[model samples]
Target: MSSLRETVPWQEEPDDGTDGPVVPSRDGAAEDIRLFDGAMDPAREEGLLAGLELLGADAARGAQLDFELLRGWQQHVLHTPQPSAFRNLPAFAKKGRERYGIAPDTRARLDACLAESSTAGGRSLPLAARAARACLDVCFFHPFEDGNARSAFLTLLFVLAREGVALNDVGLLRRITFQATDPQDALILARYFDAHLAETRRGAACPGS
Candidate 1:
């Protein structure tokens, strides 16, 4: 498995609805998708790279992962049951789109933000704050036909990991997810992630004998 830096390309431009720099054909795509199906196999190592790559691309504004694309990747890798991929953006615009529907405009807004965040420029804040804002924006936008929350969470992890931030506390993230009621709640969660990142960084400092 390649390092996240090595496997994923960092793009400064927005994805223009193309297949991305690393397009997956039927055969190649299947192999890439299979890498992250939640199965306990050596492939997971490779799958993690693939998953990071996808999220990174999304973050970089390299491409959009519609519901179908997300489900296809999930099925190929994890073989999990998911909603139909035929859903379009208008279907996602209704109230509670998080449950069913996605607004096309909102999807574009979120994608643009993801792309901006992926690149290395922005206001300096606690790492967790940035992650929280990014993740919350996606969750609030609920852009995809499905898996908006999952995508937001995964994208947050991928961005932080790329920044060399340690995030070994899945429990904390899960707890925050359950607690978040709105965008503000997500921001609060980001504070926690920032604190965790700071502590981890301190712990990694070399010990002086």
Candidate 2:
């Protein structure tokens, strides 16, 4: 069966623009920076950062990603820290544009996607492209009951870190959202990753470091 797909209003695609803190330090990378410039919900933002750190540590240690790891990330994002469990019922997602149907084999499917995303240490495609596709996979899968978007964001970071591409600036990555069926979404995201990588390399320092 076809999975859920979401449609969003597209303008000529306007300009894109652009982490951290309250999380335990591990690798001594930058601790905290704003993902967005304006005000944000402090508690939610803190959870996101903590979750990212947890994901980042896994990436740093060369750990393979699976559904259990994803659940761990979700728990951290919610600051709830629960055992692994997929969504038990149909769930509306993507601003309520679509309903994710309950599937009997969702756990196995999500695990397959994670396994497929980790292919060959991402040698088959350019590093950023792998990351973009991984982001889309997590976005479309909608594996958890809550924080799927945050989970997808963490996946992007994990893929990037696996390939040794760290972004001090996340302007393109965080400024927009993606659905599973967004045509050309992967290509557009790859270009954004490329731009972010180029900008980060040119600056020669982490944006907030």
Best by lDDT: 2
For candidate 2, write residues 82-132 as lDDT tens digits: 754788887777668866666788767767666655646534445665567
Tell me each candidate's TM-score. Answer: 0.51, 0.76
Q: For residues 1-209, what per-residue lDDT tens digits would candidate 1 score against the true structure? A: 11211222222222333111221112222233344333446554454445555555544553443333344443323324653343355433334433433454554555555554444465444455556656655565554555455556565665565454434343355345422233345455755664554444444453231
The lDDT values for all models are 0.45, 0.64
The alpha-carbon root-mean-square deviation between model 2 and the true structure, to one decimal in Å, is: 7.1
Candidate 2 lDDT score at position 91: 77
How far does residue 121 in candidate 1 sit from its true spot (Å)?
4.6
**lDDT accuracy of residue 58 in candidate 2:** 91
Winning candidate number (TM-score): 2
